[model samples]
Target: MRQLAQSGKFRRDSTLLEAAIEETNTEIQERLKKDRIDFDFDPYFAIVRRTLKALAKEMIELGVELGKSRKSNRIGERQKFVSEAQTPFEVIELGLRNAIEGLVALPLAKECVLDLERIKQDYSVEGEWCPFRVSTGNLKFIVDDDGTISISLRNPSETVVKEAKEVLIALASQVYVGN
Candidate 1:
């Protein structure tokens, strides 16, 4: 964390570094260092793991197959090593502050959300790469984006639904206390 912060990407804007200003690099360094030491993975990540397991179990019960999309893009590992942030600290500082609406980058993310729909697929997972494609659409969409956007209220073909139900049953059966 110290090495990443000292790399200088977290420096406040130069325009703000004016004469007579109370700001100092020493303060920034200390704060970053402090946050790094205080930053607990549990406050941001452990709960998330629990939540995913529960949700995945639920989805399986609901018979959501989350059929394969394209392929694994290794999003988790890549994001853990963002281009500007070779280290995790840089990514956190640059993206997430104290609370994220969120990584609370990328809600302690590369977070895979189940949109419960098939559309607008964005990121690709790394650690637990999914054979199924998904978007953090998280059921949230930009209401005011450019383009001819249209929403169709519908469901998949009967056969697809049947297959999904079958798969859901299979998965739900496999689900265990640790799952």
Candidate 2:
């Protein structure tokens, strides 16, 4: 009878134990919510975002510099032919031929090869001009009489082509004209 009374006194009530467990769970959940809120508003994330923006800007600036250098080299090559030409026809013919050949020999980023035989210069009587058309894989480059170059890519539909062309133009403009 004495042992039974002592055990009863020492025994924990189930209700009290349950209440304590529930209170601890609630506190833990609240702490987790607060931690989530702190993480969402962290200044480190803002710093990272700003750093990425700055890096992108710097990359664009570098691309522009590279494009300008390439343009200058092309201009120099054309100038060399122009200086040696006795007539305007020779200037146009020789310059276009040289430029197209140079482009054909240029190594692309990938292991892609451009067929030199496919490069052609067409003279238009209406415009009194000659433009070179160069084809490589699905891409075509048309060099106009006024030296303006345009790119065309093959697609199944006109709408798709237009949409894809915009993206290609954006990327090409970055590497080519840097605009």
Candidate 3:
């Protein structure tokens, strides 16, 4: 009985040690990924694209609701005037611009700089004015007036890229529900 108890204790200790080693290895890998300065923008761009799509959907829904309300005779004339003053496309564009600006203002994106004029002048391949551009080191995120987003990443860190995605998503959620 004594020998069995001792062997059981040894096995438990070995298992614990293995688990600790595995945890440490995982931590190291995470640190390495975070520390990596060179990032490909494809993954990050996908994230942003998805976020923008969701935001656009929300904006459309809001616009439709506003339109429906305006069509009702219950709304006062002044309220109807206010609602009709801005078209749905205009509202969505303004909301998108504000959301992008808000994303840059987040703590994670403070290190990133947005240059609207530069993006318009340099990166607008469609011959249309680009509304915003965010730069982190050599990475650039350009958004055109028509809700198209493109990314240029140079020595971009995984941490910053992930944070950028998070910031955009958070802003989208906040702006979508008027919170």
lDDT against the true structure, each candidate = 0.26, 0.34, 0.36
Q: Pick the candidate with the highest TM-score.
A: 3
Evaluate model 2: give its lDDT. 0.34
TM-score of each: 0.18, 0.18, 0.21
Best first by TM-score, ranked: 3, 1, 2
lDDT string, candidate 1, 7-108, tens digits: 333333221222112233345446779777533333434454445544434433332221111123211111232223221211121111211121102212
Q: What's the TM for model 1? A: 0.18
- Residue clash pairs of candidate 1: 75-125, 76-126, 100-104, 103-107, 103-108, 106-109, 106-110
Off by over 4 Å in 2: 1-130, 150-179
Candidate 2: Cα lDDT at 77: 28
The best candidate in terms of lDDT: 3
The superposed Cα distance between candidate 1 and the true structure at residue 10, in angstroms, equals 36
Poorly placed runs, candidate 1 (over 4 Å): 1-38, 60-148, 153-179
Worst 10 residues of 2 by lDDT: 85-94
Shift of residue 47 alpha carbon in model 3, Å: 36
Model 1 per-residue lDDT at 40: 33
